[model samples]
Target: MRVVILCGGESSERDVSLASGRSVAGALLDRGHEVVLVDPAAAVPVLAGPLRPGDAIDGFAVGKEPPSPAARQQLRRRMHAALTGGPVLELLREAELVFLALHGGWGEDGHVQALLEMAGVRFTGAGSAACAAAWHKGRAQAVLGATGVPVAERVLWGPTANGVPEAVRRLLTAGPVVVKPVADGSSVSVHYVDSLPQLTQLAAEMRSGEVELMVEPFLSGREFTVAVVGDQVLPVVEIELTTSVFDYTSKYQPGAVSEVCPAPVPDAFAARLQELALRAHHALGFGGDAYSRTDFRCDASGEPRCIEVNALPGLTATSLLPRAATGADWSYPELIQRLMDLSTR
Candidate 1:
């Protein structure tokens, strides 16, 4: 199979996407598939052919903070230049399937998927509609809640929506809360705010920006994630963070957190997690055969609560999906092969 692994967009998760692209491309190559690694934002191929064992590869590193507004503006300018200058569309059309190693921004938000759909190109993971539905945290939660899945109570605010003051008022009356960007992954811009002052400050910062943000009452419990692939639910993954929030560092940097696959929980509890994960996946209109990861958090009562569903989950070595796959007795290469086969089929 000829696989073109797309990665490194102008999204905040560009670094993580690059890492995922490298890992997926290498695994597909090992499985005897023809793989081309491309960074669509830059409109350049990182690799023209399959990788050989012991071959050194250029690696992308993740920073602790997301790119600033100015930097992101610059990235958009470069992206526009590349899209106009490079043959990205032609290359994508030629591939048997595109493994979407890209995350966040246009990649995960349904824009890229729409283009691929228009071109009649096969791609891994969910389709455009599903991606769009799941990319917005509030909308995803609403869909899941409507389908009988338990999701945390959240307050959404943004430029178009003037709910920030209400959110802050609620925080003042309640207590500490969890704040995060509405459409980001890898826990970028996720934070735990403790007091009214913090909430007010954060809200002010967001009001001055163009990003939509969501806040939910902090649930004091363990965090877990479940991966769904081809109608089957993989093992649950538990995240243990050393800090208050699972920020960029805790997510990508080594030793910043500890992850356990097939999370240490009772069979019934794990089964429930898997069930809800599948439900969330379907509720968001994701294909039953597509691959996605649904995050969850157990409240003080130990009941699982849905967070958000990721359509194009990261495929890096330490990514939760791969960890869950490993727990299900699938190697990295085998997992990559299975996802590719699903897309082609």
Candidate 2:
């Protein structure tokens, strides 16, 4: 089968997406499938023609900091023009299937998926509707919560925070609160703020014409995540945070946080995590053949609340979903193959 692996978009998680694309491309190539790696955010030589059987693509290691908002916007404009008038479209047209290794921004927010669907192509991961709902953490959690899944309550601040002071004041009544971007991944710009002064200060610092934030009561207990592919629920992966919050820096920084797969929890706790993960995945309308990862954090009473679901979870080396798959005895290549088989089914 011919596969076009799309990655490295103009999002905060661009590097991580590139790393995922490289991993998938290599694995499929190793398994004797023709693969073409394309980075819509930049120029890649392979996009000049049809899918090729062998192409050694590398040097896409993740960076510590994501591109600034200004930079990302600029890149997005440039990339949009390039994709509309470049050979990348040609490759997309010729490929038998497209594997989306993208995360965050339009890639994971339904824009790209809708475009692909309109073009009549089969792709890996969830459909456009699912991606849109999953990208917005607050909306996704609300859908899950409405379906009887417990979730952390959140107050959103749209493109421009309408009432920052009011939101902060309300969230402070519940002790501490966590602030995060409304539609981003990899925990970028996430803050666990305790006092009103601190939260106000953070809000003031981030206050801009395009700031999208959401605040929720902080859950101090353990943080857990699990992946679901089709009907298979992978093992639980526990996150051990090193700081007040698992911000983007801590998430990608080595030794910043330890991730334990098949988490050292009791049998019942593990089972609960698995059950909730799958529930959150399906509650968000993700298809069975697609894959997703759901996150949760326990409250003071040790009861877990669903946080959010990731439609296109990372496939990087240190990513939690892949680690869970490894704990389930699925090698990296086998997991990739299984996803491909399921996605094209």
Candidate 3:
């Protein structure tokens, strides 16, 4: 199979995406598949053919902070005219499938998926509308809640939001709350706030930005994630955080976070998490080879609550989905093959 893995776009998660791309490309190459790894934002190929293991795997690091906005803006400037035509499109049309390793920005928000659909190219992960639903934290929660999945009480705060302070106060009444951009991934700009004054100040700071933010009660029990791949639910992964918040730094850096796959839980509890994960996956309209990871955190009551579904999850060496796959007895290369089979079926 010929695979064109797209990565490193004009997104804040560009670093993460590039890491994922490297991992995916290496695995696919090992599996004896013809692989062409490309960063859509690059004018010339980031790496050309005669692809070797180290060539595609080199570079692309995940820092404690995401790429700066100014950096992303410059990349976007260079990318705007490149993605529409020429070699990138030719690669998309020539490959058996385009595996999107992109996260955040236009990549995860349905724009890239829509473009692929228009070009008659099949890509992995959910369709455009499902991607849109999963990209917005508020919308994902709404879809999950309506499907009877438990979700934390939240208040949306943005530039246009009125009575923001009072709404935030309502969430704070429940206890410490999580404040984050409604659209980001990899925990960028995500914070834990336990005081109204702090929350208010942070809100003001975030409000000054263009993206919408939201405040939701922080669940204290434990953190876990479940992945759905081609109608199958993989093992549960429990995230043990050294800090109260699993911010960008803790998530990407080593040792700060510990993940236990098939998360040491009673069968009943694992079943519950898997069910919630699957329901969230379906509620977001994901199917076929469209894979997703539904994040979970239990409340004080010990009941698991749905966080957000990641339609285009990270596939880096430290990514949660791959770890869960390992727990399910699938090797890294086997996981890639499984995704390829399901995605290109």
Candidate 4:
């Protein structure tokens, strides 16, 4: 199959996306498929044919801070122009299938997926609507909650803090809470706060438009993620981060955390996690062999609470989804091929 692996974009997760694209390209090539790696941000594909395991992979360094709003807007415009005109777009339309190795920004938020669909191209992962629902954390949780899935108590706050619901404000005062960007992944701006002062500061930051956030009572227990491919749920992967929170560094950097697959939990508890993951996936309208990764944190009573769903889950060598697939005894190449087969089905 001729595949174009779309990777880096203007999002804060661009580096992560590039790494995933590089690793995926190498895997596909090893399986004897024609591959082209493209970074729409660069207005062209790598054109190097296929990457080898030992090849050098280059991308921007991820910092603790995110890109400024102005910078993001500029990059979006550049990427839009690049995608609409040139050989890269041509290749995407011509390819047998396009593997979406993208992580954040317009790439994972459904904008790019919609465009590809309009161009009559088949791509890996969920469709546009499902991607949109999964990209927005608050929306995804609402959809899942409506379906009777176990979701954490959360309050959505937009730019200004004045309009916050009184009930939500009360919930914030009762216990430790988590504040994070509703539209981002890779734990970009996630913060765990237990004090009034910290909540005030985070709210102020949100009002400044630095970030839009959702607050959820911090669940003090184990964290596990389950991956769903087509209708099959893979094994659970328990995340043990070095820090109190799984921030950007702990997620992408090696040795920052230890991930255990087939998470050493009771069979019943593992089955529950898998069931909730599939429920969340289908609730968001992801169907026909679509893939997703759902995160969970066990509550005090040992019940798992759904955190969020990642439609375009990372495919980096060390990403969670691949680890779960590996736990199910599927090799990395086989995993990539499975995704390709599902996308083209």
- Angstrom error of the Cα, residue 186, model 1: value is 1.5
Tens digit per residue, CA lDDT, model 3, 1-345: 778888888888888888899888888888877778888786675454546444445646787778788888877876665567777788888888888888888889998899889999988878899999899999889878998999988878877875556878877887899999999888889999998788878877877767699888898889999999989999999999889877788877768799999899999999999999998988998986689999988988898888889988889889899999999999999988888787766
Backbone steric clashes in candidate 3, count: 0
Worst 10 residues of 2 by lDDT: 43-52
- Candidate 4 lDDT by residue in tens digits, 12-129: 7877887888788878877878787888876444635555444544433445455667776776777797678777788899888999998988888999999999889899999899
Q: CA lDDT of each candidate?
A: 0.82, 0.82, 0.85, 0.84
Best by lDDT: 3
Per-residue lDDT of 257-320 in model 1, one digit per residue for the tens?
8999878899998999999998888888878558899988878888778988999998887788
Give the RMSD in angstroms, all C-alphas superposed, for model 2.
2.1
> In model 2, which runs have C-alpha deviations exceeding 4 angstroms?
44-55, 159-167
Q: In model 1, how large is the Cα lDDT of residue 34?
A: 77
Ranking by TM-score: 3, 2, 1, 4
lDDT of 2 at 109: 92
Off by over 4 Å in 3: 43-45, 50-56
Candidate 2's TM-score reads 0.94
The C-alpha RMSD of each candidate to the native structure, in angstroms, is: 2.1, 2.1, 1.8, 2.4
TM agreement with the true structure for every prediction: 0.93, 0.94, 0.95, 0.93
For model 4, the run of ten residues with the poorest summed lDDT: 53-62
For model 3, how big is the CA root-mean-square deviation?
Answer: 1.8
Residues 1-345, candidate 2, lDDT per residue (tens digit)?
Answer: 988988888999988888888888877877778887787877453532233557565646678999888889876986686456567777787788898988988889998888888878788988999999899987887899888788987888665555455766787886889988888899888888888778777877665636778889999899999999987899999999877777787776567789998899999999988988888888888878789998889999999998888888888877877788889999988889888888777
